[model samples]
Target: GREAEGDIQKGQKEKEEKEKGREDQEAAAGASLGEEAPCSRGALLSPSRKAWNPGPAESKLELHPLLNRWALWFFKNDHSRTWQDNLQLVTKFDTVEDFWAMYSNIQLASKLSSGCDYALFKDGIEPMWEDSRNKRGGRWLVSLAKQQRHSELDHLWLETLLCLIGESFEEHSREVCGAVINIRTKRDKIAVWTREAENQEGVLHIGRVYKERLGLSTKTVIGYQAHADTASKSSSLAKNKFVV
Candidate 1:
């Protein structure tokens, strides 16, 4: 769940670039930029269609495929509409080249207006807590200071996305559902949502891999918060169930 934002002024919630910017976030100990992300994996193999062809020669380009299909969702905090109504599906991709095409084309996280969000979830799962796959799960939350929004937000967000499509968690990847980035007026946040909160070994392993993949420096810590706890709270902040 999220804090009540209906009272937030409309002017403040306007998107940075309606056709460009929007995504979501939080802070953590430290992390890498994941420059070497293997974005090869995506979802189902697309059916051959002339509409997908770029041109005569390049049309035959073999795209690197991902292990799973993923969907990108966008949310605009609108006081007039229900939260569910504001969420929209942007697109779906399952190939490395396609993912990059989409990524490069979209607005960077830092450019999004306040209250806008971007969620990259496995094809079948929604990025909200009510989904069956996420109901009992929790997220590895990373909170970012306001200043870091301009400096680290884009790099960290890209790394987090790479970690997802690249399947960085090894055996624990199956337990992962999706990730969300919230661009708020105050502190920004990025969270990786998993299917189970009680899977200690798996959850902790994911946290470690995430931190390592992001190339986080030692000393700082990131926390994990269950969806149930977050949903029931009246505030955006939730108690940490685990930390790494």
Candidate 2:
């Protein structure tokens, strides 16, 4: 028993060390992200040696990897194209620096033309209501007024991105599958999609943390609607399963 306890302690220590190293790498990347190429997914994945150098023994470039590989999807409601064809995979990134690099290069949420959306989902999960990972899940939806688009849309979307990549939901992080921001003509929306809408506790916890991260007004209320619900009915008609 004592030997087993020692082994567990050693494992925990190793985990802590690994986490520390990851943070250090992310910090280094943040400091030098300005040098990265714009619109280069390759740069996001394979940062050049000129941008990072941790030590003589290590590789010329090392980046801080995230817990989950995420793919960014862009959707423009192109009337000429089918929905699937309209949605394009912009890029995928699994490192803090890559996320920052790609994000910096892209247009802000407020700047996206109406009927366009930006979605970041874990690799292998499609950013659609019909996606297997999303079909059973729901989203905590934050609807913004037309005016708020100019004032608050970009900031809130950035915060939502940071929350997902940072895993800010703690024990409920895995429940969060992805997030989306839609730019519309009159009203805009941002939603954090979770894996299981039936997991009331986990879903609610994510809602609370997400709302807090967005720095929403305490009087404001947001709603969570399952994909099953939203898929069957128009979003305006879907009933909220939960709210925060």
Candidate 3:
């Protein structure tokens, strides 16, 4: 409850400041302040904090630091509303504890109805083809048969989210954009999107790490497809550029 309250407070403060900054920039010839202020970045990004402690009560909880802040989004399909309108921001967190709190409180991916999607992306990056961060990226897709939806969907989705937030890929982790779980009628799909399609080495490394983390069988095959291809061709017919 405390963690959830802290997240709500943080989100509200950030939203208000963003709105105010936008208005101020519009009045000041359209040059907006960057997302991370200089002083804040210096404090947040510094390596010195690794050794700092906030004393006893805080020390009781082991703080797991993440490489980046991530935003969780939910898309509830509605025939009466546009796609963008149905997509809503749930919350954002940069720590392992907060992530677990949010994940445990929300409905599992398996419980979501067909046409719904859960996307976890880097903060400030929207989970869509239109977002500049995702425009050039591609996804490593794991398609599940309809029969597997009830049994494996939720587990796989949670594993994927943990892999991303935990920086499990080591050096190649920086190339990861986010992961998505799309609930569909015929099949449910889980994909991990990376920022560059052309970086074959990094892409493959990420894929290997992802597959290993999920404990996927050697018989199972997953494909990687560039966003450019998915954007032009229908998703159902999109060709795979790489497979492992």
On lDDT, the candidate that comes out on top is: 2
Residue 97 accuracy (lDDT) in model 2: 62
Tens digits of per-residue lDDT, candidate 2, 1-244, equal 1111121122444445444455466565553434322222233333232244232212233455677899999999999999999999999998766686688678888989999999999999999888888889999999999999889888888888878876778878889899999999989999999999999999999999888888898999999999999988989999999988
Model 3 residue 45 lDDT score: 27
Measure candidate 2: CA RMSD.
8.7
What TM-score does structure 3 among the candidates reach? 0.75
Ranking of predictions according to TM-score: 2, 1, 3
How many residue pairs clash per model?
Answer: 29, 0, 0
TM-score against truth, every candidate: 0.76, 0.77, 0.75
The 0-to-1 C-alpha lDDT of every candidate, in the order given, reads 0.74, 0.77, 0.75
Worst 10 residues of 1 by lDDT: 18-27
Tell me the lDDT of model 1 at 193: 93
> Which residue pairs show backbone clashes in model 3?
none
Off by over 4 Å in 2: 1-61
The list of candidate 3 runs beyond 4 A from truth reads 1-62
**Which digits, one per residue and each the tens of the lDDT, describe model 1 over residues 58-132?**
223345667789999999999999999999999999876577667867889899999999999999998888999
Segments of candidate 1 deviating more than 4 angstroms? 1-59, 234-237
lDDT per residue, candidate 3, 147-221, as tens digits?
A: 998888877887788778766777788898999899999989999999999999999999988898788998888
